[model samples]
Target: MILRSLFLSTVAAMAPLMAPVSSFAAEPQLKVELSPSSPKQGESMTVIIDPPGNLPPSDASQLTVSFTKSGAALAENYPAFPLDAEGDRYRAIIPTSPLDSHGRTLLQVSDTIETRNLAVWVQKRNFPTQRITLRGSGSGGATQYELDRVAVFKDLVTPIKYWNGIFRAPNSGRVSTIFGVRRYYNGVFANDYYHRGIDYAAGYGSPVVAPAAGKIALIDYEKNGFRVHGNTVGIDHGQGVVSILMHLNSIPTTLKEGDLVQAGQQVGTVGSTGASTGPHLHWGLYVHSVAIDPVPWRNQSVD
Candidate 1:
């Protein structure tokens, strides 16, 4: 009886070890969620991904995303970054242009274990036309040098995210021109012209504040060759979100590039410095170098 009892104890101890090796392996678990499931044209979309339990925190770097529209591939594969320090979850922002057709859009999120394809319905948005006549002749377009200076940093992706909540209005004046408005410059229909940013009818020298916390990426003046983007100040709000303040009257002497600024902090004053018909402020918000409507960003916070 003693021997039988000892044998039973030994069998129970060995039972788990004798089971199949596959049982010990971790099961596949990769979940994805989208905010504002049905996105609209000129709006930004956020992709949240929860990696499998077995993947290490560093594996989040390996995650990649590609987009497809109307059976054709869109841009290059975009990388996903860890949203938290633990690396359990990741995030990516997809920017929609004003010209992107409204229809079914497909996105594929892939990892080591499995690849998930997500279908997104993009809603259509109508934009109005605005005709403007410059006081003096010719197009006051930005020079190649000025365009290059601003273009180099627009799509840069910083590792850290500085914004936490909704963005505030930079100036307290009423909006003059909304974004995405087609333009007839001087009565000749300018084929590729659409209002890229919002125009505020702020008086000369009105306080222009930072909409969100960020690092000052650029500060330039008209004398410095910023012909069209007169007296520009660009703040990088990390993770591909950037704010470009153009036609400013002045930027604080103490404020320089790479300086940290808080929301509502005074960075410049409103003015019609660059190609101005009058004194006003032009604020352009960009994601991944693509300018989208700032109204959605002002209404809700991105998680």
Candidate 2:
């Protein structure tokens, strides 16, 4: 006990004379942000990263991010795209609707050096029910719908094209039906007929505009037989982001497949062409094939 006390006293006395033990270097500073930070289910979330001032410009694109939910990795090693010349910052999109695998999803973002476990919140959406009856081209059965979704989901050809500016609203009218609403047809609940797009209660001749720049991927009247989606125009806004304008009375005579359109350009006029109950425009936005809420995308730039 005496020796132990003497040793402690000697060590304390020598501490001032000895150089202090080295400490670890400070961690790098990274500014990470998520927009629509508290996203509801079926919405898209964006992650923006701003690295420390000392980070190299060449390393900007190398700053990859990983996504997780409930401690499980949702996406790993996903490349973050640089938005500007300096390349000190980056951005990536997380289309949460298609992540149906997560029963109770908690979106997260993490890089090799930092983590944001509570990056965003995904809330449950309670939607009201709507009933409709089909006639004419809209009379097709589930077989056609199954086939159409299969087609649209396969349009992964475009490289991710950064949106140049804020997306504009297709129709200037009020929204009649919100996205992801439960549906009933012929007095029976239809599991397959969720309202996958936003509906605008426009008049029969109301004009619809393109929300962003892209080529016309399809102007389908026969693929699914005008019944499921009447006189539809699917715009491929490069990089797997697509926008669909449906229930058109007619596509512009000047507009054709493969034609590049500018944002806010006229695409079609509204009508109850297919199985629609009344004159309205159904505007659907998608990442690949998964439907996402168009609300946030409007007045927002992907760039």
Candidate 3:
């Protein structure tokens, strides 16, 4: 007992002589940059985060982000993934809606230690209204079966990025109806309805090509009860960017799901297979399952 007490007293005497360990180290600062500081409605914006050398532990599992518009919360705890194999660059994409109000949008990015808020200005955009009367528009609205089938492909997000640079027109034709157009069917105002895709008035049996590189994710036919979205082809361009071609007359017998396709590759032919008055192709581009305008994508390249 006496020896133990002597050892304890010796350690206590030496405790004050040892260098103090810091319990409160400064938090690491992350570099956050947005591709377009000001984006218009129906456009996609990317958020990039670069951490310091010593930050983000070896695991670096999940870096999360959230968005708020005019004090209204949108997505919460949305994931941001490493852009490269080395885990240095992290990125996430946010898609703006045509109905979104213009103002400053706030993005909250967080890690284990700290959180940061990024400000982005959203520009105003206007969409025109179109009045149309269909002679035979099927059973009217989309059936539950058709909706369920299309939803699966629209929500798909492949980890790989298959596209680069600007996207091309799926078919050579004049745009009959641009995206985000409010529509009136038979003089009845379509409530909560806006054209989700651009209508290309291409000739019957015209070749329909892929706008960008991707993998064929879905192929549905009109004969299979896809009455609303007949002869549809969906392409997953990775990282939440997807392309959907609807009302195709024919798709090559050899091309199936999981096949890698190059930009401008022929996928099908235009037709009036579903919910259409005449021969036309509807091309819709979605980001994170939200339909956005393809004009910006065609005009500028998003890194």
Candidate 4:
């Protein structure tokens, strides 16, 4: 009788431990859906997660999402949600990197509640550029030209918060010239000129949209006395993410300095203005004056 009683006590002690393990083994029921599985570089997509009805509405911040791409940089906003009173919706913006080409990509989203994965393919485009000779017709013009180039570089270091978001594409087109591409202007071995912006090859009058909502910071007509950039607009998207649209045919009537805008809103049209030789758009993205390539943001999965 004494031995039997001792065995019963030992069994009771181990039962509690096994009960917890079995409870954890039960996977929580959940579901995830992504909109527009395939998108061009510099685009935004939505991700929705449906949990079991028994689970109460939870904060999205507790969840995590990430992306991985071969030969491409992944840029995205993380844990973005909770700004509204209505809970259960989370949003993020993804930007593809310049090195990314036509190929497969991956996105992974997980949390204590559930895990989900997705794969996507990127489209390819060929961006072309040609060299042309620029000559000074006036005998004294060469010296003036040298001085002008110096002045522009001097002001390049002035840091400014022009826009917000991780970074976004100014428009859609095959990337022609990437940021940091060396250039030789007039055989002078122009200063390791990195293409500060991503060039898009498109027809004239192609609609150029604002990458993110922000206020117009500057609109100028003349940069080098030749009406360079023709009509240009800069929007400060907050947090130092600035978007500059150059070679614009015309600015929208509703847009002006200090005017508010939303992401994907039409701000101007493409044109062969200023220093451009053909009809295209020069979309520049700046982070506090540091120029970054916009190619990577395309087709990025938002966190």
Candidate 5:
């Protein structure tokens, strides 16, 4: 009960921070564009908006973005903000769901009075399922999961820094499990269970690198059962973009949180340290705290 209460209070405090800005003038001229033309389930895409430059420099309007189909919201993510002077288009990401339809997606981008809808066609991608007993303590894992969930929600929403281009692969190894597959664990069947990241199979001590320039947000090497990740590190790349490297075989003793790391810098090495079947790097990416497919980010540079 105490934990639940604390969670609710935390959410309440976040409410005001997430409230949409309602101070836009009527009928502001804005246009939205979806890049790649076609995307896939769990893939990352962009939604660019041409903001009106007639407004004063300080007249910042809230650009709200959501991916929905038949009235169900599949994802919500941030794009780069502040329509540049002279009316350049601003970019935001549209991260798709693991279970989204192969075709016919509706993207809603709006400010206050103006709402625009873009029809998107997403290609199909298959995600495999695995049913395994969690090798970590259920209680401790649950606690850390709750804490990380809230912390990620709060941190990823604010993309305070901007780095141009798409992210690179943390490692060149092959993926053991694709993102967004159904996960059936320990006799519990839940429709929402999906692998949030890609697992790269590697030998013990294989190097793991940062995919983009960002500040290290977290480094956990604690031995308590709660450290189910076992030497995990989080990087915040600004613009509400964040990525995490988990289950490292080894973490550098000199590394610390808040250190700025460039793209492709070494963070740790592949390991089977945490509840894993073998040595591998589990890398996950998020926008506004929502998990998205990292494949597209690896393939192309998103503006």
Candidate 6:
């Protein structure tokens, strides 16, 4: 109760700071709204920023939006862009990390002339883990790129919140492969390439749920040699947070781009569709564009 009160106070204080850009002044009026306003700490939220009026296209590049939790430094890729076009009405999918705890999140929207800000309180939720296997193929020489991606993610960001909400066990079994574990394919050393996501060892046909609320951004199933993230579903949680669910048996044909979803919603099922050794779910989280550890946020406490 105390935490909730403090959260509310912080949001109230931030409201006035987010003023509309006055017409007399040459600034875009900024307004922000969080879909499903109250969300669990590890869950995801869509941040929509609306510009006051039509402005010349020449100044469009000057507009910017950002989000940050009180004590943590904002990630470089924050205020991420959608897979589609870019314009005055900017949208980003923001995911709250487990480390976020109880605090106010500030969303700043600005143009060349003026800036506006909004504050939001993130609630807490319960997340549990289920075991599953992840299988994928990679080019013989791509080991370096894969490993570096993992290293950079772990070193840069602190895993404090579960931006993708709670993950359900993809299958009823043990984790065949843990996150951050070193791997060696065939007889070569996969140095620096710690696994970036968790692999639950589940049989085929296991249900895969949306880690959090988001819009379906991209779906790819082409055969690209050594580029192992096969048959993937990428969900954009506003404010630059994205969830990638890989190696699916089949993506629901009904699912299409720009589809809004809720936590625990079914998106796909586990399968050995692409570059795979077995059937499982390769779940990953990205802040803005930077990949981060998904485990910490999986089962975390807000207070």
Prediction 2 TM-score vs. true:
0.71
Error of 2 at 270 (Å): 1.6
State the lDDT at 284 in candidate 4: 75
How many residue pairs of model 4 clash at the backbone? 18
The true-versus-predicted C-alpha distance at residue 193 of model 2, in Å, is 4.9
Name the weakest run of 10 consecutive residues (lDDT summed) in model 2. Answer: 15-24
Tens digit of per-residue lDDT, candidate 2, span 1-303: 699447544543442233212212333255566676555667777778877654554565446555554335555334466656676777766676623432333433444555443333355566678786745664354356635653764355464573567788889999988888877777888766567789999888888999888888778663456675777888888766788888798888888888998888889999887667788999888864678878778757667
TM-score per candidate, chains pooled: 0.85, 0.71, 0.83, 0.47, 0.75, 0.47
* Predicted structure with the largest lDDT when compared to the true one: 1
Best by TM-score: 1
> Which stretches of model 6 miss by more than 4 angstroms?
1-173, 184-192, 223-227, 301-303
Least well predicted 10-residue stretch by lDDT in candidate 1: 11-20
lDDT of candidate 6 over 1-303, digit per residue (tens): 899667666666557555554533544356556653555555556666565664443444566767677565872223423222334455555666544555666766676656776666666543343333435753433344434543333233221222344544433446766654545555454544545566777788788878777777766663442246666777775444567777888788899877887777888888886567898888877765444456555665111
The Cα error of candidate 4 at residue 169, in Å, is 3.5
Off by over 4 Å in 2: 1-31, 51-79, 98-119, 131-139, 142-150, 153-157, 160-162, 184-193, 222-224, 299-302
The better-scoring model by lDDT among 4 and 5 is 5
Q: How do these models rank on lDDT, best leading?
A: 1, 3, 5, 2, 6, 4
Lowest lDDT 10-residue stretch of candidate 5? 15-24
How many clashing residue pairs are found in candidate 1? 0
Residue 107 Cα positional deviation in candidate 6, in Å, after optimal superposition: 18
Error of 6 at 244 (Å): 0.6
State each model's CA lDDT, in order: 0.81, 0.67, 0.79, 0.55, 0.70, 0.59
